[model samples]
Structures are given as C-alpha cells and as structure tokens.
Target chain A: MTTAVLQERTHYLNNGYGLKSWLLTKDHKRIAVLYFITISIFFALGGVFASLIRLELVTPAGDLVSSETYNKLFTMHGVIMVFFFLIPSVPATMGNFFLPMMIGARDLAFPKINLLSWYLLIAGGGFAIFAMMAGGVDTGWTFYTPYSTTYSNTYVIATALGIFIAGFSSILTGLNFIVTVHRMRAPGMTWFKMPLFVWANYATGVIQVLGTPVIAVTLVLVFCERVFHIGIFDPALGGDPVLFQHLFWFYSHPAVYIMVLPAMGVISELVSTFSRKPIFGYPFVAFSSVAIAVIGFLVWGHHLFVSGQSLYAGLVFSFLSYFVAIPSAIKVFNWTATLYKGSISYATPMLYAFGFIGLFTIGGLTGLFVAALGIDVHVTDTYFVIAHFHYVMVGGTVMAYLGGVHYWWPKMTGRMYPEGWAKLSALFIFVGFNLTFFPQFILGYLGMPRRYHAYPPEFQVLHVASTAGATVLAVGYILPAIYLAWSLRYGPVAGSNPWGATGLEWATPSPPPTHNFDRIPVVTHEAYDYTAVPQEVEVV
Target chain B: MSSEAHAHAEETLALREQFDTAEQQKDASTLGMWIFLITEIMFFGGMFAAYTIYRSAYPTVFAVASSSLNVTIGAINTCVLLLSSFTMVMAVRAGQMGKRNMIIIFLILTLIFGCIFLGVKAYEWNEKYVEHHMPGQAAFHLEGTPLQGPAKIFFSLYFAMTGLHALHMVVGVGILLTLIVQTRAKKFSAEYFTPIDISGLYWHFVDVIWIFLFPLLYLIDRHLPK
Candidate 1:
C-alpha cells in the first residue's frame, strides 16, 4: 500500500502544476485532455442545436424558431457533431492517450506534432465559432456547391475555411499515428502481436492521411469559386455541380469510416476484455479494418446514384457498395462469435458494446437499401438517410466511444466510476437511441424530406417520439459527464490492471507517469492471451 | 580525447530521448516526409482531376486558352525551377559530405533560382492583367475566343493551379530562410542534417509540381492555330 501510494504520488496528474504545464504540454496524454475539453464543448454546442431542431419538429408547424433558424440549427448541429465531435472523439483523445501506452513507447513518434494537431483543432474551431457568430452558414454540413458557392447568403467561406484548417490537423495526427505504429513499437512487438485497437487506428490513420487532403483541396476550390469566381462546380460558369458531389463524397464517404473505424477498435478491446476471451478470427478482424478503408473510397458514387449519373455507373457503384458491407459484416459476426460460450460479463462497457453492434447492424443493413438505385430514388434526402447515418455514427461510434471511456476511466483518472449508474445510463442510451431513430426509419419511408421546419400532420407522431427520445438520450449522455466528474474525488482508487487486462497499458500504474512506461515492454505473446499465468511486477 | 571520439560524442548528444538510436529517428523522419508528400499529391490531385474532366469536355477552348499563355516565359520559368531543384540536390549532397560551405553556397543558389521563378511568374500574371485575361474581374473579358465560357474556365483553372503553386513557393522560401539561419547558428552538423534533407525533398516536390503545371498549361496547345 505504501508503495502504491508512492507510485500514485508521482503520476502524470501531479507531476506538474499550473495552466502552462497543461497548455504547452508535449505529452500525448495532456494533448488528449486538451482535445477532450475542446470536443466536449463542441458536443454540448452541437447537442443544443440538436435539441432545438427536435423541439421545432415536435409539432407539425415551425413554432419554436423561424425556418432560416431551423436550417441554421441543423446545419450547425451536423457541422459541429460530424467534424468537431465525432471525427476527433475517439482517435484524438483515447487514441492519443493510449496508442503509445499500448505499444509500450515513451511517447508518440512525434510528440510535438501531436500537440500541434490539438492546437490546430482549436484554431480551426475558432474560425468556425467566428463564422457562427457572424451569422451561421445554412448550406448544411455537406457544403454542396451551387447553393453553397453562388446562392447561399451565409458565411460559407469562413466555415469551409474552418473545416479546411481542421483537415490539416487530421492529416498531421494520421501521419503521427502511422509513423508511430511503423517505427515506435518496442522490441519483440511484431505486427500481429499488436492489439486490435492499434490496428484499427492504423487503418483510420491511413484514411486520414490519404482522404483528408482531397477535402482540403475541394474546399479550397469552393473558396476560390465563392471568392474569386472559379468555375469548378458552378453550372452557370460551365462547371458540373455533380462533379462537386463526386469530389465531396469521394472524401466524405471514406470519412464515415474515419469516424467509425476507431470506435470499432474500442469495441474490439471492450468485447474481448468483458467476455474474457480472445477476439474470434483476430486476423480477419484486423484485416477487415484495412479492407473497409480501401473499399470505402470506391463506394462514394452510391451517394450520387440519384444525381443524374450514368445508369451503368450507378449499377457499378451499387455493386461496389454491397461489396463494402461484407467487411463490416465480418467484424460484427466475429464480435458475436467471440461471445459464444465465453465467460461473458455485462459490464457497462459490454452493455454499450452490445448497443453498438445492434445499432450498427441496423445502420449498415439500411446503408444497402440506399445504396440500391431504385430504393435510393425513393429515400435519398429523406429522414431515412438521416436516420441511417445517425445510427452508424451516433449509435455505433458514440456508443463505443462512451463504452471505451467507461472501460478506461479507471486507468485515465485512477478512480472507479459508480458501476450501477454507468449501467443505468447505458440502458437509457440504448432505449432512448432506438426510440429516437427507429421512428424516423418509418417517417423517411413515408417520403418525409429532411431539412424542413414543417411537415405533414401525420409525421407529427413520429417526430414527437423522436423528440422525447432525444431528451432521454440527452440524459443518457449527461449522466456520464456528471458521474465521471464526481468519481474523480469520491470514487475508489483503482490499481493498475484493475480488470486484470493483458495489454501493456495495464502493466503501468493507473494514470501512467509522464513518460508512459518506466521501462519499455517487450511483447512475447499474442493479444488477449488470457490463459497465461499472472504475476504482479512493478513496471519500472 | 581524440577528435574522432569528440565527434562521436556530439552525435550521441544530437539524439532525442524518444528514439532508441539515430538510425531509427532518421528513418522515421524520412518516412514522415514521404507520407507528407503523398498528401501533397492528393491535394493537387483533386484540381488535376477537375481540370482533366473539364479539359476533355472542351478541348478546343482549352487549347486556344492554352495558347494565350506566354510559352516562352513559362518555358524559362520551368528551366529556372529545374535548376533550383538541381541546386537543392547539391545542397543535400553537401550536407551528407559535411561540406558546410558548399551546403550554404548551393542552398543560396537554390533560393536565388526559386526567387527568379517567382519573379517571372509575377511578370506573367502582370501581362495577363494588362490583357484583361484574369478571371473574376469586371474588366475580365476574353476577346474573339471560341467557347468563351470554357475559355474563362480554362483561365480560372490556370490561375487557381499556378496560383496555388506560387503560394507553395512562397512558403518554401520562408523555410529555406529559416534553414539558412539555423545553418549559420551551427545547429546542425553533417550527422544531424535531417531538416536539410527534408527541405530538399519539399523543394524538389514544388519543382515537380511546376513540371506538371508547365506541360499542362503551356505546352498543351503549342501547335494549335493562333
């Protein structure tokens, strides 16, 4: 106990004092906190926008706000949620905090670049906030040109610039992750011996590096078209607007993988740990992530099936889109098989992982419905499309993100959260999320278009249900914020390897030292080798 | 201690705490620069794809507008950029050989050629301004042009692509100036010249972009009817 106390005394939290230590920190863990705090604010702001959008839709009329305001609300909701919150949620915070620890490195390959990436996110957020303050952009998060470039009397350039700057931040983080994975692994840590979380992130990093720059250039063209009257995507000036969709979705579609792949990684960790078994078909799961990232790029044309593309092109894209789902199915099946006949525990993380699988399955299956030409003609730009993405992004990624946070909270804060409350919140989120989005699937099939302030009286019942569920889902999200914060002072001190996990991160002290490991770990076994005998040893 | 031993000690001092050895650090840095270059390719690749699609759609207008650009100046600037890239290569070689004076001299030469390329670009842009060929201005009007709309687009892309290349050149100059100051400060020796090598990579990359831009913009319709 004395030695545990001594180790705790010098951990990362108390190693330094004051704001400067935190703000200027080159430590990947501290940088993760910087990202965490910023993205949390973005989440709150996005949630407020979401709440307003829902409240306005609770009736058949636009009662709460003007139509323009409603449009701005959903636009900000998506812009803040997708770019500011979801994309950075897992990879920046958890990945940065844990990737080095998992690989047994003192720090990321380029610690200063990691810090710069966080700052770039903030600077980008500043531009976005400035644009919002100057009157928000109303072109929606897709920023489809013609409306965005030539017509919308909103702050399009400022918002696009914000997203553009943030793209560089993503690129730099991806670069850091790739190099770290390639060059920073400790001796004896072969590629397959590395944890699935690292593999998932490596795949996400590849997408970030290769896919983000295209968007950066795409937005640059948008900026030029707006500011300098470049004729790239404007039909009035002899350009094809369909080309805009092609280029935008070219990056933005793979961007969906960017948002979910890291969360899939977190779920891989949670399912294996809570089930007390190695992941089933580990190589298949690892390779599927890479497959998804690559295959994701070829399926963007599915978004444009209804956009006057050639009939033959749509057929090819539809076929490719169906092909992309095979890898995702493989992951889901592997996770389910990992649970069969295993010692499964319904920890809060496990509950949320279960939530992710159920919701992502519904989401992924519906993606095919839209990927088909005939069905997409009926459902594209409707609430069904909205519901489909929310399921995958919100239900899938956010659920895994929360679950991973709970599973790692003890290690992150050196304190155990209240398990009963955490599980209750998990249940709240699952039930509330279904209530929120499941009705929209029906509403969208009924031909209700999205981005509207008013709809038919028949749609009111579903919208009301979604609004009510949003309130519950909001509570589900807020509970973690309350308890996780409260646990810092009042909860039990969790020792290293509290769950008796097998990864190198668990080998260090809970709340690891400034340099992640006192001595670099040499890997000698495959990931999730739970059958090995245990012995307690000081990391240093 | 012998001078050789003293130099070995200095090399050890140059190693960072994060790396296990100098070789690993160098390899990581080189790989990182290569990855960054790939992103740059993708960044420019978007515009290239756009240009290709539009150019194929209106080949005659694109060729006519291509002829309007001064091929002589474009050809000269291309040569100038190629020379700068060659000098950058010499700078990297000098750094590898520990010839500090040669490194400095070659780097300055590269910087000079880069400036000359920019100066020629500014002069060409000035000529376009006088001829009312710049896009987005009220005075902008293409005269006696076939497919005026497509011709306008060709100029729009010409400016956007080359203008972006110029912006990269400006950034390159700033980086070279920093490297120059750092070299004078003796912050690097031959054993610790990763920054110089990476800068060489970036400089050569900028030249390669112009190599593509020169052909696509200046040489595309050289044989077309004036």
Candidate 2:
C-alpha cells in the first residue's frame, strides 16, 4: 500500500471526532483503547505508592514515614495495584481489542455491554481514588476479619465499595467474551482453529464468571459488617473470622490465575510469532489454559494453612495447589518446545516473552516451595511469600502485558515504537525486577517478614538492595511510557501485519476500521499457520 | 431447524451490524442472559455458604432464632414472589404472541406483584425492628437465649441474605420498567421479544432465590415450636 493510499483510507481512529464519539463508542477496539488509558493511569498511581514503599524500606528504622502511615501506604498500594491494575492489565486492553478480531468477529457478543464494562471500571476507580484522597484504608487489601470490621477506623467501606463495583466490570467483560466465543465465531472458525489467546481468555472468562461474584458478595458482607455491626466476621459477637478467610480466598486465589492466565496467553502468541513457528503441542497448550482455570478454583485453601484451618483441609488444599502447577508447567514446556528448531528473532516483544519464561519459572517454583505444608509455615508471612507473588504478578504479568502491547502496538495505533529503546526497557525491567525481588527470597528464607515498617540491621543491607533495584525498575517502566506516547505521532507508520503475524486481526489494516473487518472473514486455516499469513505485506 | 428459521425469516427484525444473522444476535442475547443469571446465583451462593457454615456451628441458636420469625408472613411473601414470576412468564408469552397490548398489560401485572412482594418485605422488616430483632442494637434481643450473641449472628445473616435478594428484586423491577416503556414504543415483536424473555428469566431467578430463602430462614426446625 502506498503512503498516499494509507493516508486517505479511514479507520476507527479518524472516523469520529470529539469526546462523545470516543466515550459513547460501542466499538470494541475503541473501548479497548479507553480501558488501556484508564488502566495506565491506575498503574502509574500504584507505582507511585510502590516507590514510596521502597523508599521507606531503604533503612531499618522506619524514619521516612510513621508506621501508621506505612500501613495505609502498603494497603492503598495493594488495593490499587491488584484490583485496579494487574487484574485489568491484559484482559481488558489486549483481550478486549484482539479477541473479537482474532476469532473473526466484528465486535464482542455485546458491544454496549463492552462500553458499560469500561464505565463500571472507571466508576469503581473513582471510588478507590476518593478513598485514597480521604486518607486511605489501612485494613490492607485482604480486609481480613475482625480487624477490618470491628477495629479499623480507616476508609474500609470506600475501598471495599470500589472493589465491589469493579467486580461487576470483570464479570460483564467475561460474560461478553464467553458468549462471543461461543456464538459469534465467523464461518469455518471451529473451536480448535481459534488462537490460543482466545482460548486462554475464554478460560479466564469462565473463572471470572464463577469466581468474581463470590468476591463481590464477600465485599458486600464486609461493607455490611463495618457499617451495620453485622458481626458476620467479627469474633466478639460470636462470629468466626476463619470463615471470612474461606470466603475471601475462594475468589482471590482464582483471582491470581485471572491475572496471569491472560499473560500466559500473550506469551503463547509472542512465542509462536517471534519463533516464526506454530506453537508446539498446540492442543496441549490450549487445554492447559482450561486446565489451569479449573484447577485454579480448588486451591484457595493453600492461603489458609496457618490461619487455624484444619490439618485435613490444609492437606487437601496443599495437594490441589500442586495440581495447578502441572498445567502451568505444560504451557512453559510447550513454549520452550516451540522455540527449539525454529527460526527465532529476538524482537522486543520476544525479549519480554523470554523474560516472562525465566521469571515465571522462578515464580512458579517458589510457589511450590510456599505451597508445601511445612515450608509454608516457615515463610507464610515472610518476604519469601512476597517474592513469590511479585515474581508472578509483576515479573510474569507485567512482562507479558508489555510484550503484548509492543507486539500489537502497530495494529493498535498504526505506528511503530523505537525498537532500540523498546529492547533496552525490556532488559532493564528484567534485570531490575530480579534485583528488586530475588533478595526478598533470601531475606524471607532468613526470617525477614513482610508488611513490616522497621527491621534489624542485618536486614537493612538486603532491603537497601531491593530498594535500589526498584529504582531501576521504575526507570524501565517510565521509558516505555515516554517512547510509546512519542510513537503515536512521531514514530513511523506501521503497516498492517508489520511483523508478518497470523490471525484475523493482522488481516485488517493497522488501527482496524470501524466494525473491524471490511467483511467478516472466513477462517479455514489453523491458528499460527505461517503459510496462511501472506508474507507479501510491506515494511516492519 | 433451517425450515423453521426460513418460515419465520419474514418475522425477524433488522440485524445488528456485528452479527451475521438475526438468529445469531438472538442466540447471543439469550446466552448472555443465562450467564448473567448464573452469576447472580454465585453471588447469592456466597451468602448461602456463609449461612451454612455459621448455622451448622450454632444449630440450636440458629433454629431458636429462625423460629421466632412469622412463618405466615414469610409464606405470604413467598407466594407473592412466585405469583410475580408467573406473571412474568405470562408477559413473555404475550410477547411471543405479538399482542403489544397484552405484553404491556401482563408486564404491569408482574410489576404490581413485584411491588407487593417488596411492600410485604418492608412490613416484615418493620415488624423485626419493633421487636428489637435487628442485630447489634441496644434493645436487640432474641426470645430464646441470654447470650444473644449467637442469636445476633442469625439476624445478621438473615438481613444480609434477604438484603442482597431484595437488592436484586429492585434491580429486576427496574429492568421490567424499562421493558414496559420499550414495549409501549412497540420496540419488540413476536420474533424479536428478547428483552421481555431475558427480563422474565431474571425476574424468575429473583423469585427462586426467595423460594430458597423462605425455607432456609423461616421454616428451619419449625416442628420444635417457637
């Protein structure tokens, strides 16, 4: 296509103007952009809270902020990061944008509902930010029992209300995905022929439908208990707090998979595309997503090992936790196999995929370490536990999110980011992330606990090391924000399928036209079949 | 199925831009409603799980607390809700018949029944308040035990469970009102009555939740006497 032709051809971006056009858009692609911007703001806010935390932990003395302030700091950080950022990171932005196109549909099963989901997230986020501005909640994101209901005087109601409202957004998005996948697949796009990204999100949609509602009700109970003295989880009124743990973790544990499963999906695409080969064990990889979703639900009890849960129940949960590892490992092994004997390119997105595999492996292995009955006792509340999750959530999900964005940046914006800077940021994030969290593993194993305001002199060295690495990681995060924004206007126009990728999304012009396809595509080829993707398309 | 679809092809409405066919759009809408209803079930299921755990832990207190409620009023409320569900089904039937006036009329009847259920619920709650059965209040007292702590747990669970159900009822009624206006505008027909059909599913779902709530809250160990 000539530059003159590309300029004259209208797309979703230029088809409308003014606030109403963007805000009232039922277009899934436009809604995805809306979500991407909203979540980016929340991610930055969460990062600021994190920087303050790392700064506070630089010395053993808690001098930077008071302990009470520290409590609110970490609590707000967790609330914002988990609910507002990581949970919506990939699925809302990338999944929403690509799932429809990947399956050869023009929009989701419900486009108006897709728009509504975005509004719900924003409304929920408004409540969260208000709570933060009103001096923040100190009950932590978990809001465990008597402390949150009977004791804490902070803004528990506001924060929980935010999360409660946000829960609906997740459910609606999931509902839209499941229905679209089932009823809206274009002609000849059979179940097996769809991309792994769709399968992963479809599994995620199942989890979201089943798991999110429980958490919504749990938050409602928390609100009722705090406001009306319901005493549901308060012990003084003969209420059992342990049951609160049961209800909370039931959704939250699966919520982890909700966060990472989409990331796993992104890695599947990155691995297949960057290697220029079909993902090895495609059936196994696809089934592994559903396997992970199913197994993810049964292991919520692992979080309750030391919370006065019975030994019998703990054993059952512990064993079930191990089963989740099998499907996750299967995905990792499959991606690695796809790499073998394939023409591999170390593109920026693939760099992030490489980082995800290594970091996610360490994260998963440490997860097994913490899942053990005996080892969990030693490190349950320690920095070891902290290290395990950050590795997965930050190292795994964030890496995959960035990779997916970079991989599809051209299609999303019709522009190419500076490749040199992109790879540089990926390297910094990988190295700096390891530097920040790896010491926590050693510190945790050595008896340094988490959520602590102060620590002993021996722990200071490691804490300082972690803080330094965090600073580096912050730089890596900021670089992309600058370059990606710059790329919007200044970067070269990225031709459709710049990297010569497969799937129906690449078949459309970059920044796909309104209604996605010029006409709904008929998908007769298997997913990731390179031959099915025309190589004649122009410049990267 | 093809012949059936073809026979009704003239009866179908204009297609949504996204879907390939009107049937596809209708199927998607129907499936979306079923999934939404299932989510509502899970939402209530959480409260039920809490109810089960606590009730088993304090069975005697739960039974004692449960028996003090007016089962007669509860039974009447249940009947009111069940009738509303039936009216909803009738409204959906009227929609399928494409009698716009009948759809509007049955929907109004269903809405009235829904309001009746809510009115009865408000009255029962006021009765509890007057009797000081409200949890965590100064004068709050259960008839049976001196501890009242376990008894308070019962009332708390009662209010929370029913409160969530009531919230859903309110939302259901709101949806019905929207459908009523759209029906008045003749926005639907025999082949395109999805909103009515979907709202019927939701209204019935809320009624079924009340069915479970009635037995679990009001009829538990009734043979033992108040």
TM-scores, one per candidate: 0.97, 0.97
Compared with the true structure, what per-residue lDDT tens digits does model 2 show for residues A368-456?
A: 99899999999999999999999999999999999999999989989889999998999899989999999999999999988888999
Q: Write model 1 residue lDDT over A1-540, tens digit each, in one string.
A: 333564546878778889999998888888988898899999999999999999999999889999998888889899999889988999999999999888888888898899899988998888999989999989999998799999999999999999998888899999999999999999888889888999999999999999999999999999999998868887876888998888899999999999999999999999988778899999999999999999998998998887899999999999999999999999999999999997777878889999999999999999999998999999999999999999999999999999989989888888889989998999999999999999999999999899999999999999999999999999999999999999987777777887757788888887888888766878888899987625242211
Expressed as tens digits, the lDDT of each residue in B1-226 for candidate 2 is 2435534554457456777677898899999999998898889999899889889988998888888899998898888888888888899999999999999999999999889988988898898999999995889988767768888989999999898888888998899899999999888898789889988988888888888999999988988744
**Candidate 1, which CAPRI tier?**
medium
Q: Which 10-residue window in model 2 chain B sums to the lowest lDDT?
A: B1-10
Best model number under DockQ: 2
lDDT values, one for every candidate:
0.89, 0.91
Q: C-alpha displacement of A52 in model 1, angstroms? A: 0.2
